[model samples]
Target: MSERPLNVGLIGGGGGAFIVQPHQRAIHFDGTRRVTVAALHPDPEVAQAEAAAWEYPLKGYDSYDDLIKQEAAKPLGERIDYALIVTPNHVHFDPAIKCVQAGIPVFCEKPLTLNIDEAKQLVDAVKEKNVPFAVSHTYLGHWTSRFARFIVKSGLLGDVRWVDSYYLQGWLAARTEDSGNAQAEWRVDPKKSGASLCGGDIGTHALMQLRYVTGLDVTRVQAHLETFVGGRSLDDHFTTYVELSNGGRGLVRASQIAIGHKNDLGIEINGTKGSLVWRQEFPEELTIRLPDQPDRTYFRGSVSANDGFLKDLPEELMAEPNIPPGHPEAFHDAFARLHRCFEQDVRAYNDGKPFECDGSKYANIDDGYMGMAFIQASVKSSQEGNVWVNMDC
Candidate 1:
């Protein structure tokens, strides 16, 4: 017989927060896992009200402390299997570390914590607790992303030379925060969003894509963080010139002031033999370019092993379920893939089995730490007149 569904507890995501909706949908995408409880808001009454008004049935708490403490005291089968922390950057470290210490697994949002020190502390806590921790670098869940990682790391593109990774958006171009936009308000505030707004928000996505697909660590960075919108304290534009571990150079850039763009995140890597490109806007396909051949585009559900240019495909990659090539698999589907992979490790943890939280299927705690380190280095590089700063992680 199949096991009972894994119970998920939310640590934030109340009061018109946009990111939570996608996460909620992803959490319940498969019947095997669910949002059984939540501490929805910072305000006690508001949190309770929101939970009561939640679209589905769930236990609610006023704060993450209550959620973690109360839920953790229950028996294994009855308590929350894992906690999903969708709080702002500043609130991340506390609840996450508490969950870790309480023997609860966590699936947290990006950029880890507000600073490198907090990130390091959280990392150390996870190590000591030995629990499953996943950082939601959502794009990595795309099948095309997995295929791209395989292509580059498999040496099909030869030794890497250069890369360009970027994410652009237009919503913050004109001070949407001033307009009382809940998402925009917290994001533009330096106190709440942490240092380097664009970098911490979406630039990390670009940084993670480069690191994930290429499997390379950024050793050093020369960065420039700028704010185009008149009175904002944090940057709306971020760019970094990075030195890769493999001796290649790359640009990881992000902008919120680009007017026409909307979530235009993409990457291009040029190696000795060829190049690979992927754009989240067109999430379905991955493109490959060889020296003298026409570009080959591979769509999800349309690949096979041992094709002329393709080598042996990993069984896990091939066997992942998807609709036919023509039918689209976009954002929510990508998120589901992440939660699905996370579920396996979570299940393993619950069963007292050895599980890998090793950056392969999803962004693990180490990956999250690297993101904070990258942000800290980029901010330092920008502040120090754009000089090269070693990523001393």
Candidate 2:
């Protein structure tokens, strides 16, 4: 028999919130999941009004606490299969922990929590409870990312030597916080955005990309978190010199003050034999460079096998959800893929089956913890005159 669609609930994402838009669209993309309820805002009246005015009928709660409390009281089939925490950096830990304690799976936005201690607490709680938890590392959903992972980890690129993982943007080049931008305002505040703004906001994405594709951990880091725009408490530019577990080296950097760059998240890896490059803006294709050969470029749906460069591509990678080459899959598609993979785990958990929270398809709780740990280490490194800090703490 075909199973019914999973009901998902939203925490936060109301009143002109940006991230939630992509999330809700992605939730609805496959018809296997739908958002049926939400605690839309921090204020009761506003939340209620937003829900009432929502495009579709939805269950509304004044706050996330009320939503979790009530839904947790319902019968299994009548309640949300999972909760999506699209709240700010400071708000992630509470609702996520609540969902786990209440026996609900959670898919949360990144940078995990405000500090390493809270991230650790969340990790321990999830482990003790044995719940399904996914951290939204959105870019990992790209089919090319998986292919890159296979190529690098399979030693197709020889021994990894250096990687340059970075995400750059021009949005916060000026003090947009003073110009009435809510996203800019909260992100620039340390109390709301954590110790490092640029690092916590987007540098972690770069780090996740490096770790995911190369299959390595940043064991040690020396960082310089800088603030280019005047009067900002948090850094707008983030740079880190990292030592990977395999004795390789790399740089995981992010900047919001770079003019003319919009969401320029990309990675280039150089190994003993050759190099591979990928850019989010041009996500459909990846470039491979080697001596005595032309640069080999592969598109998502147009990969060829038996070529000397890509001898035998994984069938599973070839089989992952995809459209034609010219159709072009972008941000929403990546988000949908993550949700789709997460849906499988949630369904398995619901049916009392063992699910994979192994950080393979989508990021697991431990990946989220590592992100926070990296941020703290970067901040400490910067504060102590840019000395190296070990990630293990």
Candidate 3:
């Protein structure tokens, strides 16, 4: 039976928020979900104004607290099915906890929260409330990302030896924050962005990509967090040499000062059998290299299970919803994939049925906590004279 579209409420995304745009498009991608209401800004007046002037019709509240209280009071069908928090780093914890306590599913933006302590609180809250929650690690939604996970975790790659997960950008190469760029302004501030700017922003994405693909945790880290731009309170370039739980070594790195690189996020994994490489710039394909053999390039929607290189493909993955092979799914598609998976869990929760918010479909609240722990470890390692530090989760 076809169901009505899931209603989603917005906690942030006012005053020219960049992340909110992709999320908006993604939520409505399948016609199964829609943003019905929003508390758009920090200021109550501005939030109401933005809602009133919104391109489409939506209910506006003075603040997230007001939005939460009123929405939670409604019956299941009338209230929002889930809430999407696109607020800054510092605003994540409060609203997310409130949503969980209110029996509302939440899909929050990452690094999760401003600090490890808040992340701990959120982890506990989600566990206690047992609500469906997700952290927005966008690239994980890519079809090729799931394909890579199948290849590595299924032992096609043999025992992992080394991996390099990186996200690079050049937009913040200069002091764009000083020039009245709202996004850059909060990002470079430690009070708002937490310990490390580059690490908290995109470095966590690299870390998560590595973890999701390799199915390994970073047990320890030797990091070098650097601030290339002068007068910045936080690091603009973040790098960490990591010890994986499976006895493998890897690097999780990100930089905002690498000129000419625009969202150049990619991952390369080296194993005893062969290697796998994926780049977001070319989102449609992944390259595989094996000893004394031809390099095989696999494109989305164009794979056969019984191929020698790939075997025992899961039916769920093969049956995952997508357009055609060469149709070219990009940023918005990736976001939509995440939200689509999230919607199922929300539906199950509302029906009082078992639902898995496990990392298999999308990053769960635990993944969000781990991201915070990693950043805290990396920052401590860098501050302690670039010494190795064990992750304190």
Candidate 4:
């Protein structure tokens, strides 16, 4: 039997779009999944040029509504199987809801929707339609994340007790939010960006990472979220104390206005027996510190130290990989790996087989809901003078 290819319609991808290219490349790179750009919706000339560059025979549209309407007119099987929403945070909900209601699956960018209510509405729509959907939380795809999971599962880090995670950046240190940098503008606007800027944006990533490796849900949080950059409508720094369901404690901080910092997201988890640390800057190496033995370092793709999950990566990706044992795989590779997992699960869903990664196992509607809840609770707590807020995720 021949496998059917998935027709993908992209909502945003103009000449200078940042994320669309990675999504396109990831979908096309895996031969098992033949992805065709069914339609590109942007400024007509730019979209047409992009389609031509990709060698897609499809035409381009200037409006998303036109693209959706035309695609919906096709028969179910011939219609676009999935729509990738690569627009900004504020632009995510409407296109996604339309696609899901039309019986097309959707892969949306992170911070699923603008706020808790919007996120819930999108989740309800997808559930009502019973379509397979996913959100892009790319850091969960890192090799070091896989290794950290192994250490926790193997009981090498017995009974995790505490976690410390941070995501810091220097780009917005000087109030760039008001300068109309397309990305920064919407993100700092309360109307478009939703509440809790730094926490709502990158804090979701940190929370997802914490849960992914340790399998613990955040039960409550006491937070101090600050808008350090003068005149910015949203937060630039977030410091929160988190209580986990499994009796573990955690501290999470995300800052976009921190001067002199780069893209630094690092996590340290301490357990009864030992501790494990992974830093995004050093994506290939995991630090292991045991009570009885000297601290050790585990490297990705190493014959001696590679864990099962690391060893199972596609040979092509493993061969002459960007990282040596001590070197690192950059952000794009992590994004690609996540896209690969999304593709596998989507195919499995279409084929009536068990999903390669359980939708619930990865971050899903519930995680999105929880992330929003975290944002709301954190903000409420901050306004109330740093009181503890219960999160019902």
| lDDT leader | 3
Residue-level lDDT of model 1, residues 199-290, one tens digit each, is 99999999999999999999999999999999999999999999999999999999999999999999999999999999999988999999
lDDT of 3 by residue, 42-71 (tens): 899999999999989999999999999999
- Kindly list the per-residue Cα lDDT of model 4 for residues 1-393, writing each as its tens digit: 766667778887654567777777776665544444434544677666776776445556656676778787887457676778887777788888888787777888878888778888887897787777878777776766765765676676789899998898888888675676777777788877888788978888888888778878889999998877788778899999999998889998899977888878889999998888898887877888877677788777673534532234434434534545545566767766766667667776666666534532346666677788888889988999999999955
Worst 10 residues of 1 by lDDT: 316-325
Over 4 Å off, model 3: none
RMSD of 2: 0.9
Report residue 178 deviation for candidate 3 (angstroms): 1.1
Better of 1 and 3 by lDDT: 3
TM-score of each: 0.99, 0.99, 0.99, 0.87
Model 4 Cα displacement at 154 (Å)?
Answer: 3.6
The models' CA-based lDDT, in order, is 0.94, 0.93, 0.94, 0.75
Per-residue error (Å), model 1, residue 352: 1.1
Candidate 4: stretches off by over 4 Å: 1-4, 38-58, 178-180, 303-328, 354-362
